[model samples]
Target chain A: MSIFVDENTKVIVQGLTGGQGKFHGLRNRDYGTKIVGGVTPGKGGTDVDGIPVFNTVKEAVEATGATASFVSVPPKFAADAIMEAAAGGIKFIVCITEGIPAHDEAIVFNRLVEEFPGVRLLGPNCPGIISPGKCNIGITSGDIALAGGPVGIVSRSGTLTYQALHELSQQGIGQTTCVGIGGDPVPGTNFIDCLAAFEADPETKAVMMIGEIGGSEEERAAEWIKHNMTKPVVSYVAGVTAPPGRKMGHAGAIISGSKGTAQAKMDALREAGVHVCLNPTEAGQKMVEIVKAL
Target chain B: MDLFEYQGKQYFSRFGIAVSPGDVADTVEEAVAVAERVGYPVVVKAQVKVGGRGKAGGVKLADNIDEVRLHAGNILGLDIKGHVVHRLWIERSSDIAKEYYASFTLDRPNKMHLGMLSAQGGVEIEVVAEENPDAIAFLSIDPVRGLDLGTARRWVADAELDEVAREQTAELLVKLYDCYTTGDCDLAEINPLILTPDNKVHALDAKVTLDENASFRHPEWEEFRATETEDPREKMAKEKGLNYIGLDGTVGIIANGAGLAMSTLDVVNQVGGSAANFLDIGGGANADVMASALEVINSDPKVKVIFVNIFGGITRVDEVAKGVLEALKRVTISSPIVLRLDGTNAVEGRAILAPHLNEKLITEPTMLDAARRAVAFANA
Candidate 1:
């Protein structure tokens, strides 16, 4: 019942010959995702962990009828690879490359809208999306995640989710989908975008939103939740008083001018009826408290 | 990533944008020679990355070679917005009848191509655009088709560019887009795109920021980049392959986790004090990185106190504590350091750090208490 991907979803690995793609693909296959095919430019007809590989995404899709693609190309080639997959009619794309150029991402983002409206690109530098209890198409360590419950975890920080999940698992609670979303200066999915998807998913009864400094995405998402969310949401804004000039978490995770700080986001979330957790360790407990109250 | 006006103009010239003939001059003699070559009544512009040069007396009009020398001498050594003026651009002066501004940048997160156009150009268009956002129009260009001439013409016309000025501005738009994409530029701005009294259009000033990620394709830019003056702290951080940014604060922060580093900052402010900088040794924070971080922090005189917060996961607390001790040995700590080490062998780590504990080195039980005590000590 999770959003994005799950057990029955068929997946393709776009750079399957690469180290990361192969590693995550094996894990994805073990997590019950149907590994239909893979694309690795000149590595067609090859088999990676028994999954068939093709030269292009179009060929891979045609041969295996694959719907989703997990792209693991380098940052420099990420946009072009994603665009190629999009052109091939891949519906869901999870790009796991980090440090792509801002202008190149701009072009890819623009192309996503104009050329591939049917495709949903998850990340250029993100910790790919997962639809727990369904399929795992991301880089998240599956052993840490338990396939039960309806809580959605959306965060800009990857390690915080790991910590939060550790705490949640201790409480016998699990997530429907825990998305890292990545902390690049630019991301394909913002907190607001993830929030909308979570809101629409009936399986997700509660949400643990972890945000950091650097941008108004969290503030805007909090505002959106204040007026829209029906589910109990617990928020944690990480970086309230960050060092003046350091970009620590995600590239886009910066506190500048009047937007995107932990305090500002906390205030916004509080106004929206969200129980903002002050400590990362208390996030699961706080969400549990809110769920009990509900 | 920020480029000075002269560098930007050279990049713009590669795109065929009509700009007044100009040359960069570092000395008064060079300025006079450039002005004479351009046939005087030249404009002497300070070559600095920041805006507001016009109001800072960084821009001046010289009617003769003597006046060029006078303006160049005053500007070449001046400082504008913390950037010391090392060079000036001498260009044939254009008679301005009107001013307009345009820029191409990537809108964060949404990751879309952003085009900002303002009829009220020059003198900090950001302020004017903010005060009256309606006056500046924005367009998100589609990446596949790029920016078309029709769209460019429509945008200029919407911004109130006269019929005669439309073609030149439209041509400039295509060129700007080409420069933005091909140059791998994060930002390309032209302020005061002058509408000459003769109806000719010219780009009077240019600012371009290249995307550092795409620098691999531009080997020539490597030299230009090295020549550009950067914050010493940032330069040191970059040289060490560390991601560090200097902030105006008294408490120096060192954290293992990015989220924790940020939370450490929040906790500091919540308790009462400011953070000096955001230094995340990342998951790879070891004795070497820590020692280097200490040196970088020490370089900044603003850092009066230090805070080390580590919630060790994959990273061992004992390892981080060892790194701290190692760093302390190599670097003299005139300011007090408050450490809050938790998770993964924290007790053992604290025991290891016990020997190093003194007036300069302090340990707190939790992040909150550590931040509070650090701020207290910093102010003291």
Candidate 2:
């Protein structure tokens, strides 16, 4: 019933032998995600938490029938891992590695589009995606999210995603899925892509989108919402008071030449009939209100 | 990660792109020496990362040694749009028969490599794109396919570049694309890719932005880091592996993720308090990470109150609580800390902090409550 993942989705972890891979792989498995196997180039034939390991993603997919992959490799190898996942025919790839060079991402992204047209790459520096209760493929805590709710959440941040999920879950508002698209300048999926999916998902009654200052992605998403979206979407844009030309933690969370500012993003969203919240808690409350009215 | 004009020219030269031989100098004497070596008439250019250096008189053509000294003396230590120039690039000036523009940068929306080539070069490309849109030829290069000589030639012709400059320009464009990709640069731009009267094509000015994320792949980038004049706080945070940005405020804030860290800053302001800095401890909320973050925040004298906002997901609040307590023991903080613990193992986390609750160490039940308390303490 979620947008990208559900109960039927079988998962494989790339770089499963690495510390981060093993940690999150076990967590995802515990969250009821179908983590069938893993792929570690040199550490194939080993097992991580009873999960089988293979040398290549193709082998993992062949043996476990895995449809999705979690990329947990180091920054230098993350782009290649994504390419391998796509080449192996993984339908959905969620990369959790941060600090990947933009040029590497640019090459991998172009490859995914030209070669693996059907493959969906989530992030190179993101926390990944979570379909609550059914499957969890990212680093997002499964315990915080409620399953099969009327709300769908998409954000460009990690902890803020958790914050919104906590606020909603505290109010007994469950969600269908929550996606952290990552805060990289050239992330694999953007707000518009996630919003489009949310609009099509019948289970998603209302959507909550969290954005930060950077690029024109938010403004572009606002345009998409104005022209296309039918569901009520509540939103929040962080870094409202951020100083220009300074990067605020995230690589993409910067104001460049007055092009990407919180004020401009908020104005665009409001003009598109989207209720914008000032803070994370208020954003959750706005979503709750919209869902109740719906 | 932005390179100076001199460094950019050096990088371009590595890719076989023709650039006027240049050398950087810090003094008027050094500038004169460089001008003598390069054989004046030289261009005395201030080394600053910002644009409009030419308009600000940071760029001057010096025909003789006296002019070189005069220009370098003025350009060095000269403030151009708030960026003080501490170095100068002296190079042999080129004779420009025509000016063209070429650059390679990532197009985020399309997830592709964008290339802009225009016949109208000396002026800002933005002006060209806005005023005479068709004067610039825009091409989306497939990162995998890359730019070949044939495509470059067609692109040059499409931009309406002079017929004499086509072949060499196309060849140079391909090389520029190589430098853009192989050099691990976010942007490799030649604002004025000029054609001299002799039909020789060369880069007149170079602007490059290195991809900091790609530093691991290029070891030589250490040189770039050496030249960087980073803020002392930023340098210290980088050394400790903490994502920290120093700001001018009273409340010092630390959180586990970038989004939450930023939201913490926003909420702090929303509660009528300003944050002295933004620090993201990432997923590591252990004693070491917490202590390091605290040390960096403590170094900032403007901070009056510290806010520790930890919303655990995969990061356990109990672990963060223990880290906070352990960090408190390690560092003598000058300000009071307001801690907000929520999410996974929040109860256990709060229980761990129960014994440490005091006038200086306070824990709130919610983010809003925590922000309010921190702001109150900051103002008080």
Candidate 3:
């Protein structure tokens, strides 16, 4: 079984009439995800690609019994979409919109914690999650992933996640689940959250984590891995050659006042007994080695 | 999107917060005129984004017109922390009976708006937090609930500010919170929230960072963008809507995502080659986008070899390959190109490129092999 999503995870699409929503909704459905319905305000009684549409998330959830949602709205309306999903009792929400203001994200995050305690929010600028053969949600290409493998992958990047998944699948290493937590300054799910889930999954023999320069999340994850993780984990931190104080494409990938650097993160992971790879291919190879030893 | 102190003060004033009367000047004559208008005992402050302006002699009190001329002339071209000062903010100096600190920024870990209020101000808050942790009062404000007058009052009292300064400081804090939220700022800081002998409270200095994402809502931000200084390559890339950062190296690197683009840079370094820039095409690998990206990279004269690494997920490798060929036809690039195509129709993509393969255009099978070939070509 995969973590977070699987065949039983019924999904609803937010902003289904929009360009990205329609395109990825069809892709997710094609990948075997149970996209039961969609939500578009004032477009109830409509259908997008054979899926029912409703005026609100609550109505969509009521009609289709959808447990999860994919938020593909514009940045201005993304916070309200997340709130509507939470208010409609969606257990998991994956947001794929980028360029959302940090203050708006702050409000959504605080409301999720105070109002909806058990719900999980994945990303505001990420490529969602894919559990391989079972189901694919969000934007990650499903063909590159293998199902029910011994490895679990979590990353902060979209294309980098694809690179790692492709490398592992080429090496005949399948995955239980691959999660992209996104590259925003504030993400709902972090490395530690995914690592904990991977550690608990009995089918997952090893975990591969992909991080970039920014924040102290990697260092904190290293602390968590040292104390609690029982499975072997390999990791890669991007931006080793990046200049300090310049943001490297990602909003969260800035080195501020010597606080977040690639060397510091790599050193922290090494101290926790984690094998840190220098590049993406090496990261995939390191995961293969750890899984073989297991 | 970091605002200069003068710009931050302008924003604070819009929210009804008290700030010392100031006007920006670009030359010594303009500085003298601003000083004369603002009255004597003006502060000639160099306007730079970096800190330590006072210690770097970019800040000086001018009691007379000649002093204003002298100070403004020196501070205008002064180098503070590697930032050459090109502007000065001339303001009537305030009488400080006490200095306090207050700021609002996002607390990433807690996912809330964090407000820091301290009676110990005028110095770096980091030092206060490190040396006397209890001197500063930290409060996490729910972005939904927001900061009210009662909460601001209690926060001011908890910071142990003088009783005479409490009421006005609380009111100013509420206004500052309004400026922070309604202003769409990532950070709104008053390093020296001062109280004068007359028990008046006002902001002595402002440090603000506006949220660039919120530019859609605030069209007035065009003024801020007009004053920004950026690298030529970065500016061109921004105009082309490509995610790019200029660096001082030889190998120009391009990829599909931020993470992979960064990893490409690292792998180039690991293979004994340095990257000239970091460019992320971001899921759009069509002809126009690829041509624009190539044009931006080719504009940099230091680049000897261009590495185009594409790992197509939602993006198809065939579309990327076609885009690369189409872009090659549009621009005359001096650097040799090393291409790596993988995932989702990679075979078809490679076949599409096989006919175009020559001494200048080369494709590798793997990321490592592609990086090695690119580095070797760059050195050669």
Candidate 4:
């Protein structure tokens, strides 16, 4: 069983009328995702490539038995959309919008814990989780991802996952699922969360984790890997000796204090017994090498 | 997205917080005039988008016109922690009987609206907070309810504000909350919220940072675009809309993936060379985007060599190869480029890039070899 999405995950799309929602929804439908319906408020009667649209998430969930939702709403309204989806009883919600306000994100994060204690949030500015060969729930490019493997790929970047998968595929490596966890400072699911899923999956033999500059999340995850990861793990933390004060791509990719740096993360990973690759291309190769040795 | 003291205090004034009347000046002549208008004992504060200005000697108090000119002239041209002071804010200095501080900001990854209040205020609040974290009162404001008057009052008391300062402090707290919420600020800080001999509180300094995501709501930001003193590389990146940050390394990196770009830097150092910069072409790895990324990298004089690493998934390898070739044709390159193309349409991509192959545009099948070559070339 995959960690987030599976065969029984009946899905609904918020902002189905928007360009991204429609694109991913059509792809998901094509890939056999149980996209039961969509919600676009005023565009209720309209359908996104044959998926029925309702006025609100509550109505859509009640009518179609949708258990998961994909939110492609704008950043301004993303938090509201998540809350509405959670209140509507969507078990797993994936938000693909970028640049959400920090305060709005804080409110939503607090609400998720204080209000909807059971709902699982995939991302507010992240590529959604996917139970590969079963369901694809995020906006990560489908063409690059291939099903069937003992490897699981989790990353803080969307394009990096694609690149990693591409390199892995060239070496005849396939993954159970590849997750682009997004690079926003405030993300729904973190490395630790993804690691837990990869570790639990019997099909995943080893995990490839791609991290970048900013935040102590990678270091914390490295600490976790040192103690808990049952399967072999190959990792890469980006931005080695990067300029101290530059915003390195992601808003989350800033190195401020002593906690978040490539060296710090690399040290932690090394201490944890995880096979750390210094390069993106080597991440997949290292994963293969570890699996071969095992 | 960051506001200077004068601009932040303008917002503070809206919510009834007493702040010294001030004006921002871009020229030396205007700076002198503003200081004259504000009268003697004026505070010349640097107009930068960052904090710690006072510690950086960006803040100076002048009792006369000559001192004002000198301070404004020095502060205006100074670069404090990479943020250049383009303007000087001249304000009538306030008499301080006591100094107190308050600020609100997001706790980043924790995703909480964190508020900090302290009886000891000034430029040294950061150091004090670090050394004595519990000495300052911290509160997490609930998003739904927000920071109410009662919560602000409790925070003030916990921060050890004197009983005499509580009333004016509460009033200032409301203004701070308004600035934080209504202004869509990433940070709103008032240091040295001074208690005067008249028992009134005045904001001696205002620091506010706007949330970049919320720029859509404020159309007026278009008028305040100050790009002159921005890091040339950073400004160029801003223009192209590609996320770029210049580094001191020689290995110039161009990647479609942020994580990959970051990892490429690490790998460059691992193989014994520093990275020149972090450049991400985003999901759009087309020739145009690649060209922009290349242009940005080429603009950096420190970039002795280049690394073009693309794993084509959403971004086609063929497209990236074409982008590299197309960009190479447009710009004269002083540095060598190490290209590693893998993934979808890899055979075709390599073929397209094969003709453009030169001593500078070298291709490797593996990342390790490519990094080694790039780093070695950079050092050479």
On lDDT, the candidate that comes out on top is 3
Task: Kindly report which residue stretches of model 1 are placed more than 4 angstroms away from their true locations once superposed.
Answer: A8-12, A16-39, A43-67, A87-90, A114-118, A130-147, A166-173, A213-216, A242-249, A254-267, A277-285, A292-294, B107-111, B130-134, B256-260, B310-380
Question: Per-residue lDDT for A24-89 in model 4, tens only?
Answer: 888787777888899998988888777899999999988999999999989878988999999998
Worst 10 residues of 3 chain B by lDDT: B105-114
- Among the numbered candidates, top DockQ falls to 3
Summarize candidate 3's per-residue lDDT along B282-369 as a digit string, tens digits. Answer: 8979999999999999999999999999999888999999999999999999999999999999999999999999999999999899
lDDT of 3 by residue, A35-86 (tens): 9999999999999979999999999999999999999999999999999999
lDDT of 1: 0.80
Docking class of 2: medium
C-alpha lDDT (0 to 100) for residue B333 of candidate 3: 94
After aligning candidate 3 to the native by TM-score, how far in Å is the CA of B77 from where it should be?
A: 4.1
Q: Residue A211: error of model 3 in Å?
A: 1.3
In candidate 3, clashing pairs total 0
User: Which tens-of-lDDT digit does each residue in B1-380 have in candidate 1?
Assistant: 67778888888988898889989888899999899999878999988877678899999999987788779989987988788999888999888898988899766645667898878887577687679888787888765568989999899888877778889888888999999988988779898788998898888988887877788778868757866787788899879877776778898988865676777777788777998887778766688998888888888899998898876654678999999988877888778889988665678999999987998899998677888899999888
- The lDDT for every candidate, in the order shown, is 0.80, 0.90, 0.92, 0.80
Which wins on lDDT, candidate 2 or candidate 4? 2
> Each candidate's TM vs. the true structure?
0.86, 0.95, 0.96, 0.91
For residues B136-184, could you state the per-residue lDDT of candidate 4 as single tens digits?
A: 8988877667877887788788888888999778767877887798778
lDDT of 2 by residue, B55-162 (tens): 999999999999998888888888888788999999999988999999998887787899999999999887887899999899998888899999998998899999
Q: For candidate 3, what is the TM-score?
A: 0.96
